[model samples]
Structure formats: C-alpha cells, structure tokens
Target: MTTDSSDLSQVDEEAKLDLTQQIRDAILGGEFAPHQRLIEADISARFDATRAAVRTALLNLTGEGLVERLPNRGARVRAISVDEAVEIVEVRIGLESLCARKAAVNITDADIEELRGVRAQIEAAVASGHLVEYARLNQEMDRRIRDIGGHETATRLLERLRAQSARHQFRLAFHPGRASQSAPEHIAIIDAVLARDPDAAEAATRAHLEGIVDVLRHLD
Candidate 1:
C-alpha cells in the first residue's frame, strides 16, 4: 500500500502545528524570557525537531506577536513594553466588555453555576494570598466569559493579546494589594453576568479592565 501525497501533507501540517504550540507555550509559560535569542540549533535540540521546522515555528509565532525576527539576528521572544501593555489592555477593555455583555444575554444556568464556582475559588485564592493561583483563576474567568459569549473573533484576538502581554500580567499578579483589588472587580463582572444584565455586565467589565490600564500606566 502506498501512502497518498495528501496524507503526507496532512501529517507534515500537524507536526508543524504541534511544534508551533510547544514553542508558543514555552514562551508564554516563562520558560523563554522576553527578548531571549531563540537559536534554531538549540531549539531543534530542545524540542527534538529539525532546524527547518523550528525556523518555521518561529516565523509562525512572529506573526502571532509572541516572537520577533530581527534582521540577520534570527528570532527571539518579543518583549512588550509598558506602553504596549497598556495599549493591549485598553483594547481588551472593549473586547472583554463586549464578551461580558453577550454572555449576560446568552449564558445558561449551567454556565452561571460554573462561573460561580470559579468565583468562589478566586475568592479563596485571593484571601489566602495565593498569587499564582489567583492569576490562573483570573484567566479561567476570562476564558469562561469568552466561551459563554461565543465570540470567535474576540476570542482569537484576545488569545494573541494575552500571550503578548503575559509577562506584564504575571508581574501585575504579584504587585502589592493588586490581587485584593482585582478580586472584587472580577466578582462584580460575574455578578452582573449572573444577573443577566447586559448593560451592567459591560460596564463592570469595562471598569475592571480600565483599572488594569491605570495600574499598567504606573507599573515599573
């Protein structure tokens, strides 16, 4: 039996996608620091991929705003400046508020219950000073709202922006009293959505992220 050409092409595409995701996750997870050089040979060895494959993956990530390709310098993780992070959050305020408004209109009972559970966990994490856990729960809440809203375009844009700004956000998590302040804002968003009030949900989401923009403006 001969393997079809299309089958080979499909396999290659899947492999490329898998490699891309692995590298993207490493960058977002802080395994690769901002602006650190991504030598093709080193990445190939680390991920057991060919240099050509690693190069392709890096180029793909560059388009996603998670990596940068310097002229004659190969590739490295993209470093987002404080101003860029503030801009990203400002954009998110609009997208996330839209999601919250739609979620309020579209959420089912099950979604409400699931979000309430996440809210409780967020409160517990904040009360216990578990910064990392709180950060994770915060992401979970955003993800849940996006899913509930079913806005594919906003979800895609938010994912890229989130990855690009991950470093700034991670740092924000550990800022003094930031979690305490953030928890209440997230809870307000959840409450508004749970109440099925689209206008209130949008306002709460906007207020929550506008506060983030203010904090980012002052971030060292």
Candidate 2:
C-alpha cells in the first residue's frame, strides 16, 4: 500500500487509525509473536513507510498497551498474562454493565432493530461455518450496545480493554465450540437491551462476559 495512495493516505482521518490498526492486526494475527521486538527500520520495511510513520503507529499501539516500549529499546508486542486477562474482563464488566444500563435508557427503536439484524448476521455466519464472521459480529454486537448506550467514557474504557484482551480472546475463540456459543450469548444480551430492561441487560452482559472469563481461566 503506497503511503500517498488514497487507500492508505496519511492525510485522511482514517489514515492514522489504519496505521495503528495495521500494526495491531499484525500482532493479533500472530505475524509477530509475543514480546517480539519491532524495530522501526524493520517495520518500516514491512509496511513500506517512513521511520516516522512507523514510530507514530508504534506509539499509538503502546498507548493501547498492545506494545511495550523499553527505556533504550524501541517497541515490542506485549506478552499475554492470565492475571492481566482476568483483570481485563473484570474491568470490562464494569464498563459494559454501565453501557447496558444506559442503552436501556437511551436506545432508539431503530438501534434495537439494527442490533437484531446484527444478531441475525451472526447466526448466518455460524450456519455458514465462518468463525471470522462470528468474531466480527460478536465485536459489532458489543460495539452497538455501547454506541446505543451513548456512554463515551465507558465505551472508551471497554474498547481499550477489548483491544488488550484480543490477543488472549483469539486463542479462546479458536478453541473448538467456543465461538459458536458466543453468538447465542450475544443475542441474549441484545434481547435484554431491546426489552429496555436495564436490570436484565446488565445481568445478561455480566453473564456473557463471565462466561468468557470462564474460558480464559480454563486456558490458565
């Protein structure tokens, strides 16, 4: 991808996000292993970008806790940890529970409809045996919940945690039968939200995440 090409232009609003996302994709896709040092010269070569551009991308990921910067060293992909994974879910529960509560108060009819549509997409992905689609829709469901909730701070908090958890979650999702169960849990959470029941929505969201934590714990 050419740096100045419209598809990868750094001047556009999406350019910066794409750069960070590219780096993230590489790490989470296992193109770079845990604690793998990412030299600016090397990443610049890989991404076909200037050292400065690669630096900016590395800094962004470092801020998200996906990359670590040593005092004299550049950056490296962060290693996963069971303790960190558990804490991440605990933090997500707090933020997502708030989103579920706010979604009950603030979601519109159309938003609820869209959520149902998202659930349907997930079902289709499952039936088609596409785990990738299942994961994408799973993220979308959580995203729409936060969007409908309109809780910016809470959404940002959960989003960061989700990003951090992705490295571990991918492992769990790839495990046999886990991703299949995720869609149903997603639907139940949305069902509670669509019913406009804050209590039920909160409960369902909590249950959904706790279920995920169970699997992550099993990994440990």
Candidate 3:
C-alpha cells in the first residue's frame, strides 16, 4: 500500500499547523513561560509529531513574535521588554484611534448593538473569572471594531499589532481589578462610535489604551 506523495504532503502541512497552534496556545496560556526554551525534539516527542513539523511550528511562532530564535540557541518563548511593550501600546493607540474614527463614520446602529452585546459577554466572562473567555472576547471586540471601520489596510496593520500585543494584553486582563475597570473604557469607545463622533471616538480609544499602558507600567 503506497501512500500518495501529495497526500503525505497535506498530512505534513496539517501536522505543522497543529503543532504550531499547540505551542502558541501553551505560550499564551503561560504553560510555557517567557524566555523558556522550546526544545524541538522534546516538543516533537510531546506532540507525537515529526521534528520537521515542530521546527516549522516554531518558525511560524517566531514570525508572530511569540517565540524567538537565537543563532546558537534553540527557540524560546519571546520575552518582551518594557520598552517593546510601550512601543506596542503606542502603535496600537495610533491604529485603534484611527479605527474608532473610521468606525464612527462607517458603523451602523446594528453594528453598535452587536458591539454592545460582545462587551456584555466580555463583562460576563470577567465577572465569572473566566480569564480565557475574556481574552477571546476581547479579541473579538477588537476585530468587530476594526471591521466596522471599513479600512482594509488599517485593519490588516492593526491585526499584526494586536498579535504582538496578545500575550501582554492577556496577562494585563488578569491584573487585580483590571477587568472591572476596563468595562467603562470599552463602553466609552462604543458610545463614541455610536454617537458618530469621530473625535470623541479617537479620544476614547486613546484614553483606553493609555490606561492599559499605565496599569501595565505599575504591574511591571
């Protein structure tokens, strides 16, 4: 029984993706600490995947900035510095404020209602101490905001920036009293967009991100 070459190639691709997501989840879930080495052999063994798949997965994660590859050293979970975090927040502020301004012009009443619903779910997640759910909802909220803005280029840029910020943002969400405090900020951004106030929307988005950065500074 000979396996087709194309079928084997597809299987390899699927294996790589599966391993990639597994490692990415581990890093995001704090199962793999920042700067912790990810030995390819061990990961391949653990996931019961080939070393080639594990290497491809690590490389994909490196592109996402969730993992780093050193010349002599193997891959490890990326450790973002305070300065890098600040830069990420700054970029997000610029992009998100623009997203809000555009959304103010583009969003419909129905979109606003949907955003409110998502925010409500986020609040519920927080109240229930479902940190993972909250993180997922938070990302959904951001995507909705970006889509509402109707800017393809900006949305793509914001997506990359958000990917860079994902781990820090997730950790920040778990900070003491953070989830409760964040609701009003999210609401403010939604309200500004709903009111069709671009200036207010931009200001609200900036303030919300600035607040997160400020809190992160103390937490750091």
Off by over 4 Å in 2: 1-17
Query: Which 10 consecutive positions of candidate 1 have the poorest summed lDDT?
Result: 50-59
Q: Choose the strongest candidate by lDDT.
A: 1
* Candidate 3: worst-modelled 10 consecutive residues by lDDT: 158-167
Model 1 score (lDDT) = 0.93
lDDT of 3 by residue, 1-220 (tens): 9999999999888878888888887877779888899998889888898888888998998988888998899989888776688788988898899999999999887997898798688768877988778778878877888999988888877766666667778878788888788877887888888889999999999999999889878765
Candidate 1: the clashing residue pairs are none
- lDDT tens digits, residues 130-185, model 1? 89999999999999999999999999999988988988998999989899898999
TM-score of each: 0.95, 0.88, 0.82
Q: Candidate 3, clashing residue pairs?
A: none
Q: Local error of candidate 1 at 217, Å?
A: 1.1
Off by over 4 Å in 3: 1-15, 123-133
Instruction: Give stretches of model 1 more than 4 Å off.
Output: none
